[model samples]
Target: MEERVKIIEERSLSEGWFNLKEVIYDYTWFNGRVQRQSREVAKKGNYAGILLYNKEKRTVILTRQFRMPSYLNDTSDGFIVEACAGMLDDDAPEECAKREALEETGFKVKNIEKAFEAYTSPGTLSELAHLYVGAYEDDMKVSKGGGADEDEDIEVLEISFTQALEMIKTGEIKDAKTIMLLQYAQINELLN
Candidate 1:
């Protein structure tokens, strides 16, 4: 299929936070017809996300913060409750997940299990998210995590597993990665 799509040209549109590029390409259809198409793609590095749970407590750790995109998209407030996640930076996926859990939720999680990988937004965003689920305990709390970055103002929340599921139904938890991870925990009986 590499021969089916040929990139004719790529122009950088923005290189600020992430990269945005305008690409012109030729697509050869299965019927032997070629069509030229143009699209704008956002190129950000891949990310790792983790749903921290405690089987004994039947609770999960989550984070809340303002999301500019969600605010622009008509959300009443930009704040979103989501699984702990961040760009992979230079670390491996599992390492990134563990690091993010600690940085965002104050949990130094051990016994983390790999959940799955998915493209967060394939149409425009170019980042594959590595998702995981982990067991956490009171002893895992090392600090009052609000994010390590100066730009991050994360509020950590620990809620019951059942309540988390209810939040999903109420649309209080709208982030895709968080919902997927929570559903995974429920389907797998991870908190039970």
Candidate 2:
């Protein structure tokens, strides 16, 4: 497939917060036809997310925060329940996951198991997300974590696993990474 895709040109469209680039490329179809196409891609760097679970309590720690994109797209309040996550930004995926977990939920997660890495939106956005499941105990909470900075008005919630799963059915908990991790825990019987 590498031989089938030839990038003819690339131009930077924007470079604030994230990068946007317009790329012109030639693709050779399976039927031996060459097609030229142009596409604009949003380049947000890779990220890491971790689901924190307390087995003894049968609970999961999640965060709720206002997301402008969700609000702009029809989420009534724009708040989403999600796992702790952040950009990798010069840190290893595991380290980034741990950091985000602590910063967002105040849990110093120690036993983290890597689940998988995925492209959140491969069609137009360049973001690869590393997913993990982390175990925590009551003693792990070191602070009242609502995010590190004032701008991040995050609310941490500790809810039973069953309740969280029900939220999925009730049209809540719509964050993709959070849903994936929750389903992974259920399928793997991690809390059991």
Candidate 3:
């Protein structure tokens, strides 16, 4: 088969914390017809997320924070429960996950198990997320993590693994990365 997509033009629409571009391309159909298509894509780059679990306590450390996008969409207050995550920002995915874990949840994660990588929203966003699971203990608390400086206002929560799983069904845990990690823990019996 021949190459499917051919880029015609790409124009930047916005460039700030992230870049947004409008692209025109030619896509070859399965029937051998070429179709011109245009799409606007937001390029926020890749990120890493970690789910911190404590085997002895059968608990997980999570964070809740106000998310502008989620607030503008479906959430009334815009606060969401999610795993510790941050942009890779030139660092390795595992390192980013570890840093975010400590900065957002006060847990200094040491051994991270790479679970999987996924595109959060492939249709219009160019963000690939690296996922990880890390074991934590009570002694791992290193700081009163509420994010660094004035960049984030995060509330850390330590909840039982069973309750966290139940939150998934109750619509309390809506973040995709968090959901995936919780499911991974269940399937792998990480706490047991």
Candidate 4:
């Protein structure tokens, strides 16, 4: 793999919420041709996302919050309904998922099952998303979870699983991770 690609240079473009770097690399094609390319990449730590569903009630817990990028991309108000997720700081992926569930949806989820891992945006983002599904009950709600960060203003939503699936068709749910998790549940019959 190292022989396939060589890093020519790398420079930092910005560093805040995440580090952005401009990279120049030399890549050898399968036919043995070499080409130099440059690209800017956002380097964020891996994240853990969890879809909380209640099997008995056929409901899911989600969060709605304003996303600046979505707003810039032409969403009416930038508010996106998504599963509970967050970057894995120092915690293990499972711990991070549970923490995010508590912080974003006020559900102390237990017995989460790992679904799969995926890259959020392979071309631009260097983040591997660790996705999971967990069962939740009303008694697990300890607080009005609206995120621990000061900049976060999240609204917790407990909507029917059927309604969530409908939102995907209606384009009301546009977040990739959320959609993927929901589809996974449907395919795996987690709510049935």
Best by lDDT: 4
| lDDT of each candidate versus the true structure | 0.94, 0.93, 0.93, 0.95
Poorly placed runs, candidate 1 (over 4 Å) = none
TM-score of each: 0.97, 0.96, 0.97, 0.97
Model 2 over residues 1-192: C-alpha lDDT tens digits?
449999999999999977999999999999889999999999899999999998899999999999988999865589999999999989999999999998999999887999999887799899999999998999999988899877899999999999999999998989989999999999999888
Clashes by residue pair, model 1: none
TM for candidate 1 is 0.97
Report the lDDT tens digits of candidate 1 across residue range 94-176. 99999999899989987888999999789999999999999998998999999999999999999999999999999999999
**For model 3, which pairs clash?**
none
Give stretches of model 2 more than 4 Å off.
none
| Model 3: lDDT to the true structure | 0.93
| Candidate 3 ranges beyond 4 A from true positions | none
Query: Which digits, one per residue and each the tens of the lDDT, describe model 3 over residues 78-120?
Result: 9999998999999999999999998998889789999999997
RMSD of each: 1.1, 1.2, 1.0, 1.1
Q: What tens-digit string does per-residue lDDT give for candidate 4 at 1-192?
A: 349999999999999998999999999999889999999999999999999999999999999999988999865579999998998999999999999999988889889999999997999999999999999999999989999999989999999999999999999999999999999999999999
How many pairs of residues collide in model 4? Answer: 0
